[model samples]
Target chain A: MKEGNFCCHKTTERSEKEYKSLMNRLSRIEGQIRGIKGMVERNVYCTDILIQVAAVNAALNSFNKELLAEHIRNCVVRDIREGKDETIEELVVILQKLMK
Target chain B: MKEGNFCCHKTTERSEKEYKSLMNRLSRIEGQIRGIKGMVERNVYCTDILIQVAAVNAALNSFNKELLAEHIRNCVVRDIREGKDETIEELVVILQKLMK
Candidate 1:
């Protein structure tokens, strides 16, 4: 799939490059998930399907890391620079939720 | 915004209704984030922007909850019933990460 499709589909919190990368990764993950579903439906070996599932989990984590980096650099940093310390508190809340 | 746009735009793990609901909620959240960005750019009152940001956060949480419910009901259950115990481990790992 082409990158940046989500640019029209989501908010503009990331740079075009970041946005493209994110959409690209998400697209691949989406495909990976579909593939896993096919494996399940086709009665692939349990261990093999499990391994694919693990890979999907890893892919999701990598996506999260990229998103967090973009959020910090673009949203959090900008808000702090503009004297919106409230963004810090918001970030703190999300971090708590994520770490929970 | 019309619902189910993402059904075409992404992989389909959801029923039509679920896909619609999820897509609708996400589109609204996308718009909400954009609105918050506008507030930020215009130097809206800090507290007000923060409030909207909080709303966005809540929306996101709602989305997550719905998606998680669907995952447990659909993916996890199906996998387990099919004798794929490994899906349980995958769920445990994600829950741990989310709770972290």
Candidate 2:
């Protein structure tokens, strides 16, 4: 696969609306990270930049929550219904890592 | 201030090493965000992307901790020694926000 074209071994084909929403969220986060970089470059107050960083963290958390919910609602539920019980263990492991 | 040249009303001139260190961390984070965006664009598995997002969150947390410690060690300490006790309140407020 080409560099940026590399897909996961397993992929989830998100709906158009879901894909757009996720992309928009990520674009905003990318812009925020760039803004924080500019603040650092300009020697901004530590607490000020720190506040921006906190906001980015919140954004990332929200994104994760959204994606995780979709995963549970679609992927895990579908797998369990198909008798793929191993997905439960996978979900548990990832949840442990996420909650850490 | 010019478009990308805006500086904070109050600033702290970090040491050369400190400046480079902070910039490096932010650069890595910015790259990580871009990588995540690419992963999303490539329709990577939800769990894999979530794992990457968790790593980014941990990176951001480390960056905040490093900057906060420097602020406390230098800015807060200096302000207190100079009888500018209001820095304490400012520190307290930002800490509250961070903890939230």
Q: List the residue pairs that clash in candidate 2.
A: none
| Model 1: lDDT to the true structure | 0.58
Model 1: colliding residue pairs: A99-B99, A99-B100, A100-B99, A100-B100
Write candidate 2's Cα lDDT for B1-100 as tens digits: 5323464377878999999999899899989989998998988989999999999999999999999999999999999999999899999999999998
Q: Give DockQ: model 2.
A: 0.74
Which digits, one per residue and each the tens of the lDDT, describe model 1 over residues B1-100? 2124443321224566876676576567556655644553444433444455456556656755776677787777887999999779877876665543
Instruction: Return the lDDT, model 1, position A14.
Output: 42
Least well predicted 10-residue stretch by lDDT in candidate 2 chain B: B1-10
Off by over 4 Å in 1: A1-100, B1-12
Worst 10 residues of 1 chain B by lDDT: B1-10
List, for all models, the DockQ compared with the true complex: 0.05, 0.74
Rate residue A44 of model 1 by lDDT.
42
Q: Runs in model 2 with CA error above 4 Å?
A: A1-8, B2-8
